[model samples]
Target: MKPRKQTRTISRIMVPTDFSPGSAEAFEYAIALAKRLKADLILAHVIEPFPYNLVEGMAFSDYGDRLTPPVQRLLDHQSKRAIKEKIPVKTRLIEGAPFREIIKMAKRERADLIVMGTHGRTGIDHLLAGSVAEKVVRLSPCPVLTVRSVPAASKPGSGKARSKSKGRKANVLKDKATLI
Candidate 1:
């Protein structure tokens, strides 16, 4: 009998979240994949620093009272949940532009892969607003997987199905794979 070869490629996955629905989907997907692959997961949230002018207006004590505890609580809660679910995870909160911070963390941690969500904006909307997922996919040292949410009622052959077909066609042009 021939021996089987294992083809699993990911050892660690970094998922950056803003606690949005899309990010939540990415988190869930990452956890499931990690469980199957027995890989470690890192959950990152980047808090962009307030503008200098804004920071200058606040008292140091006020800033501390208003910011640190809530942020820490959120990270602690998420980390505990991941551990309780039996998925090895490390939670981090950094200060910077989300895309740059995510990329920096990924490289620093030597993450094997990144799983993130795209808001799926286009044209003027996309141009006026840049996407963290798009930037990460373009600049990250390792491979990035982007996930988008599909509506619940869009059955095959329905009118909504046409939109999905168009999305798939666009994805081919954009080089995105819908893993879910």
Candidate 2:
């Protein structure tokens, strides 16, 4: 007897955003994919607490509370894009370690796939700060798709005319030590 082929259906997609440029790109990608797949989106934002002693006397809970509104606004704005595409979107505002929360949410929602942004950090920076996307990818229960932000210079129609002046300034800035 021949075995029947099993086709996987992606009914739910989870997108975790940090409101960064990379995340914006990922969100847009997720929106288009959701529309094409006819899948519902679960947009998640995790409000990571300030590192120990990073905020001096301010309590971690207080720091998270102050950031909640702005982060929520960002989530709402991204959701509008999905809604405009006629794709159903559910937003999750969570406070904890971002990677852990993202993993938990994906499993809790039974998401078939997770689409997120990668900052593409490397070497020293990546070693010290670690990477939420990397951690999530390692631990997630579902398939992970990571999107990296494209540099403006590489985009089509960027043009040599615009690059002449702005590009020189960018190069100079790139040579200097960046203050975090």
Candidate 3:
């Protein structure tokens, strides 16, 4: 008798982007996965709440209004790429802490997987600047994949030397879920 192959069905894939290079890389990764799995992409961007409602007691009701258009344009541009590849996608713009919102979005959309980017900050940097990707991986309702930006030196045609230092750092920055 022949052994059977097991497969997991992924109907929706949630990808959160902050417009950073790492985020862009993750988006591309998610695109490929969506194509391969014949799944829909859910592109999400979160806008953090403003620190204060008023500056010198001057209320700013248009804060969200002013911030949303530009971000929406970027999100639209990303979605178009998936559309060009014939992958279905939807965009979500939410206001809240990024990691929390991403988790909530994934649950609400019933996504099978969440793919996002990590900056790979280490040591003091990682401690001070907590990772959103890390939090999502820990809290997400579904599986989460964190993609890191490819170092420029590691790319083909780049003469820069690849650093060996990564092997020495806390593996969490190197590979979030496994390290934890």
* Top candidate (lDDT): 3
lDDT of 1 at 163: 53
- How far is 86's C-alpha from truth in model 2 (Å)? 0.9
Question: Clashing pairs in model 2?
Answer: none
- State, as a TM-score between 0 and 1, how close model 2 is to the true structure: 0.81
lDDT of 3 by residue, 1-180 (tens): 989998769989999999997887677777777887899999999998778885565456667777899999999998998898899999999888999999889989999999888888989999998989889988989988888776675654534333443222223243422212
Best by TM-score: 2
Q: Name the better of 1 and 2 by TM-score.
A: 2
Pairs clashing within candidate 1? none
Worst 10 residues of 3 by lDDT: 165-174
Model 2 lDDT, full chain set: 0.79
Query: Every model's Cα RMSD, please?
Result: 7.2, 8.6, 6.6
Clashing pairs in 3: none
Off-target runs (Cα >4 Å) in candidate 2 are 53-57, 159-180
